[model samples]
Target chain A: MKLTILGCYSATPRTDTNPTSQVLEINNHMFLIDCGEGTQVELRRNKIKFARIKHIFISHLHGDHFFGLVGLISTFRLLTRETELHIYCPKGLKEVITLQMKLADSWTNYQLIFHELTSTESELIFEDDKVQVFTIPLDHRVYTNGFLFKEKAGDRHLDMDAVLNANINVAYYRKLKQGYDVVNEDGVLIDNNKVTTDPNPPKSYAFCSDTAYNEAIIPIIKGVDVLYHESTFLDQHASLAPKTKHSTAKEAATIAKKAKVKTLVLGHFSTRYDNLNDFKSEAQTVFESVELADDGKTFNFD
Target chain B: MKLTILGCYSATPRTDTNPTSQVLEINNHMFLIDCGEGTQVELRRNKIKFARIKHIFISHLHGDHFFGLVGLISTFRLLTRETELHIYCPKGLKEVITLQMKLADSWTNYQLIFHELTSTESELIFEDDKVQVFTIPLDHRVYTNGFLFKEKAGDRHLDMDAVLNANINVAYYRKLKQGYDVVNEDGVLIDNNKVTTDPNPPKSYAFCSDTAYNEAIIPIIKGVDVLYHESTFLDQHASLAPKTKHSTAKEAATIAKKAKVKTLVLGHFSTRYDNLNDFKSEAQTVFESVELADDGKTFNFD
Candidate 1:
């Protein structure tokens, strides 16, 4: 799995810093999260193939979160893209996007499917054979949702030597990989655990942004492999965090510690501060494993 | 009068090139014309003050022309701008912009007034004591209107030598500047023309873009100080110009020559060409005065 930070700043986009947007690649899917203004250019700058972004997940309706959506959609039509695009966002996004298309009288040749989310509770929103996505209801000034992408556990690996010793046919290897006891060629049942070993551990990533330091989410994201949380303010401005419904570096670290996440990625930084080292330093004090996210940065997880 | 080419290209915005948008500073007003996507950044790059842009004129509803408008409006609100903003665009733009504002639940603190244009003929859209703006009807796929910013004829410059010689009193100098025959101290009526000359010849600028090579607008913009016409294609691709409702460089030069304008600025270039000097060369063949519009380039017209 890999994560690319297209933009990680809060508020408006600047020449050097961009607003919230990222690409998470897992289970053969490239999911675009929170497309802020100027995201299309960022995508081009990062050299990410536009066609690979099949699904888009918006965290909120703020201009910094989803303002670039309509322009990207219109550009897709201009490029003559025929792949069906799916948008999972808040309820009002469909109306906002369709209105512009109607006014331009330029509809996309491909299908545009919208999964308007209104539920405030964490729910399963998308699932496939290899992965599942769940919305982590977040606390914010407006309706917001963070997404958790978890890879499903794979089949157990068969021990070829053990299967051969049991006189098992090649056809029975499939059953053994499925963790089932198989009948051998000698007409005796072979135990599944004796012939098969466990497969590689599944990895999961959770993206939580634009939310306050709420401890209630710790239970839902416990033991996640990687956790990306919004730390809009530093400890110096800790007082402003609660008032603005945004998290400070210390607060995000606390959540990561309580959730016992393997790695904590801090992003959505406020542009008021000149240096980003304070964020990582402050987060590391509370959580041992902490990383800072910057525009055009990429992280690899194995 | 000064014109700043914020973005001057055709079709979609690229990493290096932008779509159609320009800033025309006439009299005291810094009027923004045709705000394409990424225009706010271009404005920042060009060091234009956000507060000075009180009026925005959109040529059409095409995405390349007006997609950046809503984002700019939202950024103003985020900056806590309290000045009222006036937008003059085609009829359907108001609904498209207001709908997004409603969905984001972010109404501007400042008043947003919309002047929707449904006219197919040239008409006055904006005016003040120093300047006047009129629509330049153009041929495009959509209902489009380019703008003609004309400096209203100023008070005639008083010939102080001529006025003093005629024994005119200081109090009646104001009347002479108003281009009126004044009664001198000797109770003699003096001719206005004998004491005053025309003021700066009333400079005018016409912006015509995203249109085909049509001569109907020549009479309306005849003998204007500076004329900006779209030249989306070169002569080699002249066959595509008529089909796409865009003009070639040679065609633009033809229009400029027929209109007899002081200077002709060519813009809205297609991205297919790597060399821009050819456009100047091709246009100079038909018109003596030709200038190419490039992003971040500024032109001074006097």
Candidate 2:
């Protein structure tokens, strides 16, 4: 799995830093997170294939979080895309987007579907053969939710030589790979553990942003491999963070530590400070494995 | 009066060429016309003082025409503007901007006024002491209207020598400048025309974009000093012009000729043509004074 940081600023888009948005790639799927203003331009700059993006998750209704969404959708229509497009966002998004489309009398030819997420619970929103997506309810000023992407454990690795030495039928190799023991034609029993190795452990990633420090989401992202949390402010601005329902770097690190995530990626730095080294250093104090997210940096999980 | 072509290339916003948008300065007022995507960055690139812009005019509801409006508005709010903002757009624009504001819960301290236009006939939408703005009803798929900004004829310019020779009192100097000649202290009668001349001919500029080659607006914008018209396609795509409700360079020049506009500035070129010499040559066939609008090029009428 690989994740790319397209934009990670807070409050507004500046000449230097952008607002909240990122792209997470799990196997063959490309999922867009947050989608702030100017995201399409950033996507083009990063050389990401925007058409390959099939799913988009919007954390909240903030303009910095999803203002470029209308433009992106309009561009997709102009490109003559026929593939189905899925947008997971709050309920009022349909009214906002559809109104513009109605006024312009332009409609997309593709299957533009909206999976409205209003429930404040860990409900599974998407599931496929290899991946599953669940909502991690968060505390914020508005209707906001985080996403947890988990890759399901796959089939076991089979030792073909061991299976053949046990006199098992060649047709039963598929069953052994599925962690099942098979009986041989010679009335010999083959042990599954002897022939098959355990499956690779599944990896998971969780995304949280534009929300205050909340421990309620910890249970949903308990065993995540990597958690990207928004650190809009530092400890010095902690007073303003709660009033605005945004988290500071130290608060984000504390949440990540309490969630017991393997690693933490901090982003969404406020524009007040020119330097960002303080954010990384503050988060690293609580979370041992912490990295600051940049505009175009890509992270790979092995 | 001066006009600056910020961007004019049609279709999607590429790295080199931008979509439709421009800036016009008339009588000490900066008017932002049609904010395409990345317009603020373009404004910064051109070194145009954004704070001087108190009015923004959107031609239509097309994505390329006003996709950058929201971002520009947000940036102004971030800058903590104390000046009131006025947007003259289609009727549906209020809902779109208000919805985004509602979601973010960030209202501007300065008053934001929206003058929605829905008329099919020409009508004055804005008028100050020096300039008047009128909407030229357009024929398109959506509710569209072009703007005609005309610097109202001011009081006659006072010829200093003529005024001194007429022996007009200093208190009546204002009245003399307004072309009302008064009797001198010597009881000599002075003609108003002899004392003053026309006030710089009152320059005018008309911005017509994203519309077909309709002759109805010719009478509305007749005898304008400079006319910035959209020429989305060349003569080769003339057949697509009327059908799409767009214009060719030749068509725009023809309209300029019919309206007797002083100078014609052709812009909003289609992205299909690599070379723009054909548009200039085609427009020259119908109008003698014609120039292609290049991004960042400024035209001064003095």
Candidate 3:
């Protein structure tokens, strides 16, 4: 699995800094999360193929999170895209986008579908053979949901030497990989565990941003391989953090430690601070594995 | 008068090229015209003072012309701006912008005013003591208008030598500048024309973009100091010009020549052409003193 940070700042987008947006690639699926302003330009700068983004997930209706969505959709239309696009966002987003399209009198040539989300409970939003996505209800001023992407468990790996010793026929390899016991050529019963070992463990990633420090989501995102949490401010501005429905670096680290995630990535920094090293230092006090996410940064997990 | 080209291209904004937007500074007023997507970032890159941009003029409801407006307004609010902002555009723009603001639940602290324009005739849209702006009705896919900024005639310059020779009192100098024949101490009737020359000739700039070859506006913008006309295509694709409601380079030059403007600026070139010099060469065939408008290029008129 790989993740690319298209933008990782909070509030307004500056010349050097962008707002919240990222791309997560797992199980051959490229899922776009929280398209901020100027995301299309960032996608081009990063050389990511625009057509690969079939599904876009918006956390909220704030300008910083979903303002770029309409432009991106318009660009896709301009590019003469034929593939259908899916948008999973709050209920109000459909009206906002369709109104602009009506004004311009320019509708997409491709099919455009919208999945409006309104549930406050943690629910599974999407599932396929290879991956599953669930919503992590977050604490924020507005209705917001953080997405968790988990790879589905695969079939068992066959041990070639053990299968050869068991005198298993080559035609029965598929059954062994499927973890089923089969009879050998001599009518001897062979156990599946003797010829096959377990497959690699599935990995999962959780993305949470523009939210306050809430312990309620920790149980849902527990034991994730990587957790991206918003750390908009440092401890010095701790008083302003909760008031603004944001989290400080120390608070994010505390959540990471309590959730027992394998790795923690702190991002969505406030533009007021100039130094970013302090965020990592503060997060490291509680979480041993901490990384800082910046614009154009990419993280890889195996 | 100083004009800064923030973006000068047609249709969608790309990584290297931007859509239509410019900043015209005349008579100590900074007027932002046609804010396209990514315009706020371009303004920051140009190092323009955000507080000075009190008025924004949108040409049409097309996303390329006014998509960046809401983001800019939101940024002002985030910056704690208390200054009022004025937006002048087509009739439908107010509803589109206000709807987004309502959905976000974040209203500006400052007063936001909207002036919707629906006239098909050339009419005065804005005016002050020092400058006046009129709408140059344009032909396009939607209801669009190009802006014409003109500096009002200033106070007559006082010829100090001529004034003293006429024995005019210092207190009455103001009357002379106002073009009044004042009574001298010697009771001699002195002509005001003999003492003062005409103030710098009133300079005007006409911006006509995203329009087809329409000669009806030639009489309105006749003999202006500078004329910016859109040349979205070359002679090779002249057939596509009228169908798209755009103009060719030759068509733009023909208008400039017929209007007898002092200088002509050709911009809004389509992305299909790789070489821009062809546009200049093609335009010069019909008119002289043709300049190209490019992103970040500034033109100063004295």
Candidate 4:
């Protein structure tokens, strides 16, 4: 799995910095997350294959988070995209997008589907054979949800040396790889482990942003492989963090530590500070595997 | 009167060129003509005071024409603007803006007045002490209206030399500037013409964009001091002009000539062409006074 940060600033878009948006590539699928203003240009700059992004996940209605949605959708229409696009966002997004289309008298030619998320409980929103997506309720001024993308366990791989030593029939090799016992014409039970080894460990990535420090979500994201939690402020502004319903770097790190996440990625830095290293240092106090997300930066998980 | 071209390119937003949007400063009022994507950032780059914008006039609902409206409005709310804003656009624009506000639950604290235009006949939309705005019926697939900003016949400027020579009382000077034949306190009759001259010949700017070569608008914008018309294509692609409800350089210049406009400013260029000089040379053949619009370029009328 690989994750690319297209934008990771808070508040407004600047000439140098951008707002929150990212792309995660997992299981040969591209998923766009939280498209902010200027996101399409960022996608162009990053050379992301925009047409392959079949799914979009929005965190909230804040302009810094999803203002670029209308333009992106319109650009897709202009490109004459044939594939259907799916959006998982709060219920209000559909109304906003349709209104813009109505006024312009322009609608996407391709099928556009919206999965309105209004639930507070952790619920599965998207699922396929390779991956599953669930919502992690967040505490914010408005209705918002975070997404957890977890890859499903795969089939075991065959150990060729063991298989050859066992003299497994070539016709029964497929069954051994599937972790099933196969019997020959002699009517003998063949051990599945003799020819097969365990599949590679599954991976998971979680995205949480524009939320206050809440302990309830720790259990939901327990042992996550990678956690991207918003760090809007440094430890000095921890007093104002709770009032704004935003998290500080230390607070995000606390959540990551409690959740036992392997990697903690911090993003959505507020415009108040000029330096970003403070966030990294603060987050490292609680979690060592901490990294800051910068625009056009990509992280690969193998 | 001063006009600033915020963006003039047609089609999608790119790295360098911009879509249609401009700011016309007439009688010390900043009236934003059209707002395409990334206009607010352009406004910032141009050093335009955001609070001074009291009115916005949109010619059509095309994405390139007014996709930046919602973002501008939201930014105003964030900046804590208290003055009421007036948006004059097509009939369906209000629905789009209001629906976006409803979904985000972030309605402006300031008053948002909308003057929806749906009439085919010329009609007055906005009138102030210094400016009177009227719509010119346009031909397009959608219901579009071009706007004409005419400076009202101003209060006559007092010829200071004549005022001092006539020995007019200081209190009566205000009456003389109002074009009144003021009788001196000493019971002397003073001719209004002798003391004052006609206030700077009521400058007018006509904006005609996203329309085919429609001659009916000539009478409405007749003798305009300056006409800004969209030259989306060159004469080489004139065949595609009418189908898209756009105009070529020659066509725009022809309309300016038929209307007897003083000067012609060509803009809304299609991104297909790299050389902009072709438009200037082509339009000059039909109209002698022609200027090209570029992003961040300003034109002043004296």
Q: Which candidate is the best by lDDT?
A: 3
Once fitted onto the true fold, the runs of candidate 4 whose alpha carbons sit more than 4 angstroms away are A155-177, A180-198, B184-187
Give per-residue lDDT, candidate 3, residue B128: 92
Which interface RMSD values do the candidates have, in the order shown? Answer: 1.3, 1.7, 0.9, 1.5
User: TM-score of model 4 relative to the true fold?
Assistant: 0.93
Ranking by TM-score: 3, 2, 1, 4
| Ranking of candidates on lDDT, top first | 3, 1, 4, 2
Q: Which stretches of candidate 1 lie over 4 Å from their true place?
A: A157-177, A181-197, B159-169, B181-197
Q: Model 2, residue B223: what's the lDDT?
A: 97
- The residue ranges of model 3 lying beyond 4 angstroms of the native Cα positions read A161-174, A184-189
Q: What digit string (tens of lDDT, one per residue) describes model 1 on residues A1-302?
A: 99999999998877688899999999789999999888898899899999999999999998889988888998888889999999999998998888778777789999999999999889999999888999999998888999999999988998888888999999877778778998899999888999899987988999999899988788889999999999999988999999989999999999999999999999999999999999999998999899999999999998
Which ten residues in a row are the worst by lDDT in model 1 chain B?
B96-105
Model 4, range A1-302, lDDT digits (tens) per residue?
A: 99999999987776678889999999888999999877887888888987899999998888888888888888899888889999999988898888778777788999999999999999999999999999999998888899999999888898888777776688988787678998755667778987789988899999999899999999999999999999999988889899989999999999999999999999999988999999999888888999999999999989
Q: What is the fnat score of candidate 4? A: 0.39
Recovery fraction of native interface contacts for candidate 2: 0.39
Per-residue lDDT, model 1, residue B255, is 95
Kindly provide the TM-score obtained by chain B of candidate 2 when compared with the true chain B: 0.97
Positional deviation of A214 in candidate 2, in angstroms?
A: 1.4
Q: Would you estimate the TM-scores of all the predictions?
A: 0.94, 0.94, 0.97, 0.93
True contacts kept of each: 0.48, 0.39, 0.63, 0.39
In candidate 2, which residue pairs get closer than 3 Å at backbone N, Cα or C atoms, i.e. clash? none
* Overall lDDT per candidate, in order of appearance: 0.91, 0.87, 0.92, 0.90
